[model samples]
Target: MSGADRIAAGGVTAHENNRPPKIEIHGIERIFLKKNETNGAQESFVALKDVNLKVESGEFVTVVGPSGCGKSTLLFLLSGLASPSRGEILINGDKVTGPALNCGIVLQGYALFPWRSVRKNIEFGLELKSVPKKERKEISDYYINLVDLTGFENHYPYQLSGGMQQRVAIARVLAYDPDVLLMDEPFAAVDAQTRETMQDELLNIWEKTQKTIVLVTHNIEEAIGLADRVAVMSRNPGTIRDVVPVNLPRPRRIGGVRNTPDFQILSHHIWELLQDKGSRGGSGAQSAAVPRVDIGEHIRDDAVI
Candidate 1:
């Protein structure tokens, strides 16, 4: 069986055995008080409501939605950078009370220190944990190689391309050995080809490390390409509209998978879901038949916010 099949089967077995999920978001609702420009009065804006999800250990889940649908807000809550007005987030059966060391986040901007070299950037987290210099070097070396940045260890962020810098950001996160990785549009800044390369690299990393990852993206192809399941969210008081499973065979290549009948069908299905303004509280089928039209044209037309 393919590695992806094993992961899918293992997840099912884990659930049947009543094992607690690796991460759980229960009844999450986040409210933000914003100043109204005209009135200069504070108004409560509901960014997220009734958000709930459970991620099994070693699963890769992607979230896609229109802009302002609280995708990033969900990651913030998961990372404990912010708290929900209602609901609780739990990791390994423990409620998250504050920033968690076991959770590492990567943002769109790369967030690498311009002054720090690749090695230094990857070791920053270990430094915080007071890992010994020798041990830190060992760990950083492993991750630098893992991300295929071994030769650029002494290079600073400015010296590398956007994609390379993003790799450094990922390596830095992985260096900390976080059980869960939360990525917020980590590859959105790179070119399309580079983004595809990064997606394949990430799948390889996930296969080797078995880390549970939840990534937020505005690209539907990206969302479906990298995920074991895609969580489609809705806005205007944001909520998850559907959780769509990607059953394409495991160890997938982004380019190859896009050409498959299943991939096109899945992309069209997700596109239709996003286009439906009134869609709420529905689950996607395991498989569906969709016309062989170019899904990209539709994506470009509506632009999967």
Candidate 2:
């Protein structure tokens, strides 16, 4: 199906009707000026151009692309950490002017404080907001358990494993109660087993919280498995090639779905989209045409998988 048709056919949930998208990117372009080492002259490099996407409230959208495709740059714009040279981004009907508490960002580095215990680290945002100490403890306690880090509340970052540290980072963001969650390669640092475990845990948490999430990843399977729609991007003046809807059933287990025919099909399709030579060009219309077939129709043909 085409991206527009899939969206009209329920890429967004029924309840989101009549509401503005939770996140909207319209005609966005970002440029950076760099000095040439050879001549000491400045040149403008286009990092992203003509990017547009809409993420519904409570939606889990993943952006996937090859390296240097401005995936991280897109996240920074959404978080209001950077501005686009043109176009605009809106969150819940308000234009993103600067950093605000309503959105929380989690990075792959697990930017937890080494000096603080897990409980303290999770409560840091609440403390900055001047939430009462009693209430901060209550909030921290809830998220610690939510991310399954209840027993290790008092442990320091240095004492925990990589996965545990990441959980702490997630709980910390959730404790702030942001309406939107932006993640940049948040699981890339972990072992494969741990990454899958984290993906499952994140889905469980999303089900309970229903926060709108936008995650950026280079891992195709991870992008397909976790998102309601995967926004495939192209590099060299980055642009969203297509937003592919994932029709897989949820309460999804990352490992459980990996070998399924539908999963493989979606994976193969996204892989092809990334690898398609047309994606490297200025226009994405050619690459977007590849997903027009009904994905299920390909399942019966064994060779397709």
Candidate 3:
């Protein structure tokens, strides 16, 4: 067998010697065909393959993989925006097909509409679903306060800073009260300091809502901090290679958790995995590259995972 093939086959055998399933993904696959307009040689690219992933409800799972690995593609399928070329995805006991109201998605750019004020933007979903205007206002206000964007409610998208915009975006989703939040690197566009703040804010929200969040990110640190489990994906035909459970006790404080032996061990293990993947040009992450997908195409321009 080829080296990659041997590793692929053996790695599963080695890793799955024992472990129970949580969220089962069966033979998921997708292909993107880029047409050569002039030459007319249809170049079909496989974005994902026979992939399997298991995530427990209420589990905060973050996925990291390589360039051209189809990370965003997989996420889109999970979010019900796109369908897999072949395969089935089940969350709890049901299959995902059309955009289900049960799943809320947050993109990196804070995709707030420029035409709407912060409050209106936050209320958009509820309004679309025909929620009573009064209840929509109430829920939007509650989540607006939750995200600490109360003062900015009157402001339009252009008036708010990137971080503030993201806060509003999050609140908008939270207002809808979906069972799962599928975030596509929601914090990637902000400045480093703001990113840190955003991370803390997300944790705070998670504590309150306990929403099952499945986030796609390139930031290992962010993944470590926010996720209950991290699923590392591989190159091309992206698939979960390792599912690391973050057993660290929560009500977590930053910097401090990074010092814990367990945290350090897990981080190191994931770091090593990234390195190995990089060495073989496998994907999880790397030093030279930002280690994420571009946000523009992803609905979150900074998906560096």
Candidate 4:
């Protein structure tokens, strides 16, 4: 086998080794009420239907689907920010009752306390749990360094750049030492270059902390690059269509991976799935616009795993 193929095959073998699931989602469905524009009547909107997934301990999973596909709704349900209309979600075999301290959420908007300094913001959760002041400072210092915002501890959110602000948000959550990290399009607002940097930084941090992460994003490349598996969801009344294992090697560089044959093949596969959904009247994410490659297109010679 080629080196890349060996690495890919080994990853699958390792994954297949039986382990208990850290998160179990069974027959989950979410419904919402929306006002009908035509008759001023409340309409029941089925955002998700019968969505089932199991994420193994310490694995990184990303969920991707078109717009209105209930991706965010699923995250909300998992976080206990909202309840499923039907079915159950369990963490470590325990039913999710409400927003517990074990789950940490980093939202798309950065959601930082503008009035607080970076150090103070990172200490917010610790303060809420009434952690000792000395312990809180120690935890804050560790995560701030982990996210690489060491010197900016005293700076306010307004003073930091977009990427820096997001780092503070991440540090705040990490300070609480949650078992699962739920990120909803956290890098969507940053510039492309900064976004890639953040991606690398995040993977580094994920390695260091070993937190089970479930991230929701509209970006196809981002999903494949970061996740051990990508959960592809279908349109409104969402359901998981596939769980695509990322066979690429670890220590992936996002820019380099984008040009690899393996990466292109995987990316094309996902693109086709989304395109097929779009042709069938399923609206895709506005954030992703992967180019269509013809069968005759040139494949790069020096492919990287």
Q: Which stretches of candidate 2 lie above 4 Å from their native place?
A: 1-16, 277-305
What is the lDDT of every predicted structure here? 0.83, 0.83, 0.73, 0.80
Name model 4 segments beyond 4 Å from true: 1-15, 277-305
Per-residue lDDT of model 3, residues 92-195, tens digit only: 66788878888888876888999999999999999889999888888988988888887888899999999998898899898888988889878878898898
- Compute the lDDT of residue 104 as modeled in candidate 4: 89
Could you tell which candidate, 2 or 4, scores higher by TM-score? 2
Which residue pairs in candidate 2 collide? none
TM-scores, all candidates, are 0.88, 0.87, 0.82, 0.86
Model 4 superposed RMSD (Cα): 5.9
| Shift in Å, residue 84, candidate 4 | 0.5
Name the candidate, 1 or 4, with the larger lDDT value: 1
Model 1 lDDT tens row, 1-305: 13333333443433444667999899999999999999999999999988999898888999988777799999999999998999999999899988898899997689999999999999999999999999999999999999999799999999999999999999999999899999999988998779889999999999999999999987888898898888888666677887777877788888878877667767777776666522445422311232324333545543322
Q: Write the per-residue lDDT of candidate 4 for residues 1-305, one digit (tens) a residue.
A: 14334434545653565776889999898889999999999999988987989887889999977667788889889998999999999998899989999888998789999999999999999999999999999989898888899889899999999999999999998898889999998897888889999998888888888999999987788888898888877665577776667877777767767787777667666555554432322334421343423211211111121
- Per-residue alpha-carbon lDDT of candidate 2 for residues 200-230, written as tens digits (9 for 90 to 100): 9999899889999999988888898899899
Measured with C-alpha atoms, the lDDT of residue 195 in candidate 3 is 88
* Poorly placed runs, candidate 1 (over 4 Å): 1-17, 277-305
Candidate 2 residue 170 Cα shift, in angstroms, is: 0.5
